[model samples]
Target: MLLKKLQLKAIDYKFVLTVCFFLFFAPIVAAQEIIPDVVAEKPAEKPSGGKLKIDGIIATVGDYIVLDSDIDKGFLEITAQGGSIKDITRCQMLGKLLEDKLYAHQAIQDSIIVSDAEVRGMMEERLNYMTQQVGGDINKVVEYYKKSSVEEFKTYFADILKEQKLASEMRDKIVKDVEITPEEVRNFFKKIPKDELPTFGAEMEVAQIVVEPKVSKEDKQKVIDRLNAIRQDVLEGSSFATKAVLYSQDPGSAPNGGYYKMTRKTPFVKEFKDVAFSLQAGEISAPFETNFGFHIIMVDKIKGQEVELRHILISPTVSDAALKEAKERITNIRNKIVGNEISFADAARNESDEKETRANGGTLVNPTTQDTRFELTKMDPVLYSQVSNLKGNEVSQPLLNTDDKGKKTYKLITVTNRIDEHTADYAKDYTKIKELALKEKQINAIAKWFDAKIKDTYIKIIGEYKECAFANNWLKK
Candidate 1:
């Protein structure tokens, strides 16, 4: 588990990209020259507020990359988010970063992987939702950010994606397989004081029949040709950025005219990375294919080991025929379910392409918890779209929807239950406590695993951050 304990007055550090100072930036060096000695034993204040700088190399258990720039960027992001920076000590912040890295590093060694599409899909949905929440002025946000354009925003956001993916991978290892026996739940209840027992609610179970609209070969070729045309336009002197802004399907880069960062060995669809790494500085790529569709890439700049570039992706259009077929198939499934012929579970196993939930008997699983219950708080975008208008025992007309993944799909949902807000009980909520107990057990397992790793590994914290507070108690020694 990647645990971050933000003090109520704690300094919250997001993730940052570390940069080694080069002589090219005279101002960066000048700022450093005016600062206190790097060799100082005690923390000192800078001219602007009580900002403190630390010198050190910190490695996660599995040894994922960490740079001082990572912490520095985190500091900037933390302050930008209106965090209480002053009260949080440098060492305290460092500890959070270290904890994140430890889990991220371990996830890599554990062979936990999240797809690039999943990362970008999540990022887009979040941004879109936020934009909707705030009257859709994305431009205002970019300007307020002190970032000149959406390109700069994507650069900052990419770091966010990496940390999120790393955290997600770690969590899968920590919690995905947890199972709590009846005895364990009872024992956990005994441990919880009577007053502290978690309350439950009238939980609901839901089922669905899903159908994904398949893209046609013609649609795919059209996307490829479109990207090829864009590449040609760039070669013919039309601004590639302008074209991207006008037509890119990647919401993250579409508004920015396609400028975003690309780093060596950083996570990206292999095709995109392969095309990107092959280009020299300022080179434009021909159409390249990835699961997302076709992309045209332009290398903006190549810094020693990292490459920064912008790209435009054109999605393969879902054909009308394919979409109709998807809806018709799903509608048939829904009719069968409504008619009460085959069980929804049996239908899901035989027909639903959603591997995540089909195996669970066609029950809607909370993406965050993987539980087959409707959690009002953790409702996914897809679920919200389907369930917001549905009443219990009612089936939705086949909806043209998008899944958590970027693929187009149709959903025929049957809401099993809905309850107005009220207090909860054990008969209805034992599963919730059982889940908590299982999570607690998992945490204990991970803790034991962490201790064993610390005993076997070599770690060194250099320079200013000699003392740091990490979640792993072993770090204290």
Candidate 2:
């Protein structure tokens, strides 16, 4: 029913299509590429004549032409992504395509610049992800996508991705500054029918004090020495990328030869960015330490403000004695808080080793909402297991945790605030209501922009789709 409404309205078809694509085939390609499973499905309808079967242009929107195969491909993609095509007609697919092409066309008219490098970077990342999915075989990826060669596959999808980016940028430009005020939020809430008010789940604000196992001086020196040795090897003509693939401890980049491209504004640790920008092209830096571990970076190229580089990271091993000491330290801290010798907040401020949360009493901000409250139903399974049964203000026992990099730590957690499940209240749920109001405002802005643009733009829906009911005034009636 929801799909049918969206197909009829076409107000936010791109978002619905994106969700369907990502929910099933994300990290493989952008919404543009139809995987083999989708391409293999039979066409939605058999063409009446040989001309229709041979793939002809169905419609033209501004400078773009909609191919007959495009509608077929859209239907196949929907089916492959687990969407039912029973009610989704060819005319609806044409409407969505027309909308997309209109946005891309206006983006060009508005001089929105999506650089070739940006498109290439997106292609490379998708290629890498697809390769990894097929056991690091590029050949398998080409075969899976039914392309003769890797370059052909990338070239075909690059155009699709570029247009997708342009459409996205135009949509963003329409509502980039859309804002809602408190009164607007109140009114938006008031307009909602009483029975339709949303129910918020129980939520908790959690706090923790963490103590990481300290690496001994010898252990630290060993890791630094290892990094220095790797740097020396690279300096003596070893390929840095190959070395990174072989030895880099950073999992996120190791598979891609530790490759990273960043500008001064990239959200890397200050130390990493500082070292990256300080060196000229081809110069390798000495080992530097960040919270993740020790890393040695080599600058590969500098293009304007962006620097392309490779790195190797090495984390010092913690001894058994060090782990035991960390556990004991956290255990003692938990005892003190339990006995009321010191408040958890003060202890966290004074003694917690986790730098990110040590201040502000070790309170955790939910990444999803940028707030302190975490809905219990949506909590991470491991976190839910730890805090689900605890009573009010009850400090949990020291829990051992290990990070992806195999760094071990001990921590104590307590629920600082608990919000029970309830229907939305205007004053209590103002933040959430504000978000809803802002989103609605943005949607309205986009819809208005589309309505006006469709009238001024050259959009001719060829033969069959001319009679289809469209949500927007695409026909300029």
Candidate 3:
């Protein structure tokens, strides 16, 4: 679902996907990636609002004023969930803020620089998300902050983006080269208490042979003819909404006349988003084709980081010939592997397009376990329909398949790996445990680094936040 909306650059998505796999299988990744406990401590009081001097300092860590506005904005963001700020101690959060600033400031002094494009892109993704989370009402968000408009809110958002980016950069730098050996992983697993072990999610092993709705030259021409007629209607006073509601087969949004709030970073097919974003509010898009089908979009509105756009997706039913051809291709590939003319692994690399598995010798890894065993429910329904009973190395008949993001395709899975439920042994799950041990080691290392640096730097907390749940890493000075 997230992939559909956040259609990241393929390379970046692939990189993140690799990390996801590492973390899922390895314990250290989960521990290190979990959101840290955030809190802030108070500092020695300064008399009410005495304008702190501009000595290039905001809130001092030991000697650091974290920018006054940074504190206020941070509060606003977290507090946006609503309710009195009472239950969640503001003082504690502020102390966490101070610690963040201290690290952020240090990052600056160390000459860290964030790319403007990267910062802006992340900010856009987040802002669009916030806008939607708050009911896609940008005005309400602007009003909440009492800012002049959505545009005015960006300066503060940018600062927060910078802080986050800096902190993340620091974290990544510390952990980038960390590694875990199989032996170490085995040792860590040996130390786990049974009661505390993480349980797995449901899994699935699915196969698919897709039957695409192929539009022949004649059928495609008919579609074009119908779309053109609709466009002509729009030009001659017929509404796009009514036509879209009637003809669009992409069921996700056809009911509301085909509009959905969208952002640039989403995983919407590239062509769809590109064409959609290019239109002005009220402009009717020319007919376009995506794997799903043809579409005619209408741009309803555009907020700074988000947009309200709608479209009608019409899928043309696939022809018998197309489906037959797809199956034949799959069969040919499968036969070659069965015949040993080519290895199943090589056949997948050469013939399959699943980037996730192809690079790994076509191992069908469980999305949840990052292992071969799936708990069942996690499998794609269409894919699982075909592979339900096959044993290791057994091939299934071709069945209709769709990618996680819903691009329809076909597949004939060769169930090359299967594992039964069993108690995990360090010998088997060592790769998983090594990850946890590595992260624990890295965290301690980073904590010590921060502790040592605090003594060498000017630090101050204005509000006595020092007593709060500060990362023990920050208190060493």
Candidate 4:
């Protein structure tokens, strides 16, 4: 198994902040500059009496000061998520805070800059995730924060977000090239106590040749005609929003009457973005075909590269006859391979409509491992059922597969390999175990860099925090 791209779950505020930066603005961050560190401005609150109690600065890394409130908020967030407020946990959180500031300072010295727009985009994704968790209601979040609007909540978290993006970028810079060899992996696995060894569930390797049913000209015309009729209705004084609510297939924006607030750099599909940007304000586009089917769009307004738009997407219907015909065609191809008329690979290359796999003879590459093997537990449910009981070299009957976008395609499957559930084995589990070794090496590398930086940079800890056992010797001079 190859080391898969890291999948981050919500760990804590710090982890969520950093990882979300990685997830959301990944493409833009790569092309732009390394980014941020600073907490948002504290909104003005009622001042205490003349005998003011200042929130004392708890620690300092370089010239960046960590306030008591910062530590309190960090601790509160973790505890709110069921984490214990132990001394060690507090120490750990403080260490992270110091490290984040160090990264931000270094980023500034290195002249790495993240734009305001990037920060806003990152904040939007975080808010969206929170909104989803609370049942897709933004108002709940707003009420929780006692804010008038979602935008205010974003402003409150803006500085923290900037810092996270910067710190994450800096950390990535440190561990970008770390790798582990086979010997290291083996040694790492050997060190694990036998009782602690991981047991894997059933896994299988499957390959497929897929064929998408061709949309008949009649069906394609039906979609185009429907969109054109809606356009005609709009031209004849019917409200576009009303028609979109009734017929638009884009669920995301359809409920809001197909509205979208988009920037020029918004990550729309290339085909959709091209036509959307070309249209003048108040102009309606003719029916256009994209990968999602057909769409008729209208530009509500334009401000520089930013635009407000409404659209109605109409996906072309796939007739049952067309689906049956596609299944028959694939079924015949599978028959040919089984009858030894042509090899599976030859048939795959000649007949498979899946361009991504056809050239490789229909070998399905596991997205997680980048190998031809798959962990059956992780395989698509629809695909899994077809290959679950097949022995080695056995082909599966024709089955329908639906992609992420709900596009239907038919495929013939072959179970190329399988592994029974078992405890970790050195030879059999080398690839899976290699990831553990690589992660350990990467952690050590980061720790080494951090220790060296602590020595070279100005650092201070209050007497109270100094007593706690910290992973890093922050007090070492």
Give the number of the best model, judged by TM-score.
2
Q: What lDDT tens digits, residue by residue, belong to model 3 across residues 70-106?
A: 4444434433332123333434445456545656767
Q: What is the full ranking by TM-score, best candidate first? A: 2, 4, 3, 1
Q: Runs in model 3 with CA error above 4 Å?
A: 1-96, 130-137, 144-146, 190-362, 366-407, 412-423, 473-477
Flag regions of model 1 displaced more than 4 Å: 1-191, 236-239, 259-291, 298-309, 319-322, 353-361, 377-385, 388-394, 402-408, 416-477
lDDT string for model 2 (1-477, tens) is 432443343445454455435322433542233355543233345233333433578778899989877777666656544566666556656667787798899999999977776676566657777776567777776675468997897787788778878888887788888989888987788777777678999999999999999888899899999999999988898999888878988877776678888999999999999999999999999999998889999988898998888899989998999999999999999989999999999999999998889988999988877778889989988989999999999999999998777788999999988999999999877877788678777767877888888888888866545566666777778
Please tell me which predicted candidate would have the highest lDDT against the true structure: 2
Model 1 residue pairs with clashes: 7-10, 16-70, 17-69, 18-69, 18-70, 200-424
State TM-scores per candidate.
Answer: 0.48, 0.81, 0.52, 0.63
User: What's the lDDT for residue 285 in model 1?
Assistant: 86
Give the per-residue Cα lDDT of candidate 3 at 285. Answer: 85
TM-score preference between candidates 3 and 4, better one: 4
Q: Report clash pairs, candidate 4.
A: 35-166, 36-166
lDDT over C-alpha atoms for residue 79 of model 4: 39
Q: At residue 386, what lDDT does model 2 achieve?
A: 90
- Every candidate's lDDT: 0.62, 0.78, 0.58, 0.71
TM-score of candidate 4 relative to the true fold: 0.63
